[model samples]
Target chain A: MTADDPVRDSLERFIGKPMGEGAVAPEEVNLPMIRHWVDALDDRNPIYLDEAVAAETRMGGVVAPPAMLQTWTMPSPVIAGIAERGGAPTAMKSENVVTALDAAGYVGTLATNSELEFERYLRVGDRLKTTSALESISPRKRTGLGLGYFVTWITTYWAGEDEIVGRQLFRIFKFDPSTMGGAA
Target chain B: MSAGTIHVGDELPVFELPVTSTVIVAGAIASRDFMPAHHDSEYARGQGAPDMFMNILTTNGYVSKFITDWAGPEAMVKKIAIRLGGPAIPGQPLRFSGQVIAAEDKNDERVFEVTIRAANDLGDHATGTVVVSLPLEPSS
Candidate 1:
């Protein structure tokens, strides 16, 4: 697809716009969630759990796993009939780029890349809020699965109203499965 | 290891993760991702996946553990950038491997960039770089 393609033109308007109102984590950074992750992943990193051991290190105290930055702001799941909802933790909004792509017949989704940057280790009591903005959308291209467009977005994690703690760039390919193996 | 001791081309010890349904589900719930593909095998198969697979958040969690286990507690991760490929499904053992590709000193810290790859029989699950830093002087 070219830049002039109506679908592409429509998506272009979303670039640099906030995906939604954004979200605030329902809970602050706390030990229970940290410990659950530590056990689940078997991370065994002392700084993540052992206060005494963590205190002796340069970190000076316990810290949440750096990778958990994204986990903190994940929406709480409404378990009832989640599978019926196609695994969406909650109801999805209707006007975002994702919904737009679905409406445009590009329904298949595959994550392609992730880039996470952390400004500092999150300590207990730090509450995080997230604001995600659409970054870019590639012109449609043919792939093994089908014809697709790559959509990229950046989510900024804030510790408070002003302090940015981390950021993540997430990209995914949205394709039309029906177009698989059609004309190149 | 201390920042002073790190060098480019250094290889971190290999860490292996035994992927299983429990592992996948645990990581998903812990990460607050309710994606059925990470838990319900039937739903995943219905969606054309071979089986339930690990989520990205779980993959990043393991990746962080793999790096910090080698770099130790003093090392604070600055960045983790990875290209996602293939499914991390049950019974496939994902082997974690990495090598320090670049090292530099800036102000009071030494930063190192490490190239990492996590793979299983199906293929490479993730491949990319992680940036971590350590204080030039140990705090204690």
Candidate 2:
């Protein structure tokens, strides 16, 4: 398919009615769980590893940070080189999105920022579910690469009770990387 | 805007979610936010961010839903404004805080004027104000 394909066609079948959500079981909030995440981010914050300091804080323990949801839900690297699984290659974080674009039948694109909201906490061991939907899909004035963009509403739930923990609204653009600043 | 609906000091829903590298990496990859600070810690530090910073936009979405998610599905989000401060480092507990400061009825819709904030063990990370429309129809 050429770079000039319609962006609406560049999405995966998952884009239909396209409401998505996931539920994860609750787990105990522990130090090890907290430490690994901090270590992964290379954070030296004493709260993650230092119990003494943790007791002094309002949390009463080495509780995870407020925006710690990212530490818990990341993609596995097991499927490293499936072009069809993800399009942009291993190096590009935008790979699967790029892949989704290809599945949608469009090429060369970028993910644009819009807005987000933080609502709850996810301590270690807190099982949760995340759900998302196609909030809106409107045509932008044709840019250099594709015709328009698609935006979605992604939300995560903590444990079983809370209605929401966080929300993310993002947009993806389908275009020709070669024609623009282009290419990772 | 009516002050009775939401007092000036009422807090919005700002979540104190965990900040972890796994979610950082996964979320970064999922959103295709390829910034190094997100994927590589050593490189991220070298670049001057405090470990992996949660993508700001994603942070906003997460917190926004903390409120609207409960408010309902038909509630239309009119607008949201955010200011990012410290890097949302992994490990730190992030508190997503939002409060309704004002409210008004326009064209048959109850428009909530709210202020949102995200704080960590250290201090505030992000803050913003939002205007959202609640469903005219009552919840089931």
Candidate 3:
């Protein structure tokens, strides 16, 4: 859409706002979940499993896989509800951003890409908090699925107030479900 | 496995996962991603996906697994970036393979960067790069 379009104008307002609550993991950064992740993916890294092997490394302790950045802060029903009801969960008001797009006839949603940079590996007991903001919302564009807009968000994973453990730039496409007859 | 030993162009062993509807749904739940497109094949079909497919989180997890498995536990994955090329359609097994595209020394530590790809018969499911930190020598 154009800059003057109400949808774009309203969405633009949320560009620098916090996306959601400081999502807390249901559990801590521990071995069980890390083991489960490795099992699911069949990863046999000794550093993640074998204590002796991990001890030999400089990490001196088992560290969670870096790719678990988003998994550590998954959205729960409560968060979804907050978004649906237009509640301000946090600074990057994703719910408002998404709701605005939905009202504009972009209902179908799909994650397109994710790029993560880690400053350090996540170790056990290292709790995380993420702060994200709407980076940009693209005008409607045609693709294999259908016509939709690309929404990008930048998220920073923090271990504490000043320790930035990682940052992820994620993108998603919101389209109309009616355009479902084409190739994926 | 230490960073100093891994040379550029070293190919990592292939890891395979036989895709299935159950696997797809289970992965979706594990990652707490319930977008109907991942669990409901009918809904997914209605939304234009061939059937239930793997989510990006699962793909990212697999990518991490592939890298760490090859780099050994000692290798610390400092970064992993991925782009989805296609869906991991059910019944099509995914094969993951990678090559060390770059290696260098950083602060007396070895840093190895790999370009990896996961694919099925339909096409590539994901392609990405992983950066890991390793000691100069394997610690026996």
Pick the TM-score winner. Answer: 1
Q: Indicate the residue-level lDDT of A6 in model 3.
A: 65
Candidate 1 CAPRI classification by DockQ? high
Rank order (by lDDT, best first):
1, 3, 2
Which candidate gets the maximum lDDT versus the true structure?
1
Clashes of each: 0, 58, 7
- State the lDDT of candidate 3 residue by residue for A14-58, as single tens digits: 787866656656666788878877676666766676777778777
**For residues B1-140, could you state the per-residue lDDT of candidate 1 as single tens digits?**
89988999999999999999999999998998988999999999999999999999999999999999998889999999999999999999999999999989999999999999999999999999999998999887
Better of 1 and 3 by lDDT: 1
lDDT of 2 by residue, A1-184 (tens): 2255355444433343334324343344456655544454444544456767655543345545444554344333333443333322233433344345555545644445444454534455665556655555544335555444554545444555766666656565655434444432
Lowest-scoring 10 consecutive residues by lDDT in candidate 1 chain B? B28-37
- lDDT digits (tens) for residues B15-118 of candidate 3: 89898887787776666676676776776787667987888888887888777777777777788888878899789999999999988888867888899899
Query: Which regions of candidate 2 fall more than 4 Å away from where they truly are?
Result: A1-30, A40-46, A80-84, A87-101, A114-116, A144-146, A161-163, A176-184, B1-140
Docking class of predicted structure 2 = incorrect
Worst 10 residues of 2 chain B by lDDT: B1-10
What local distance difference test score does each model get?
A: 0.93, 0.54, 0.77
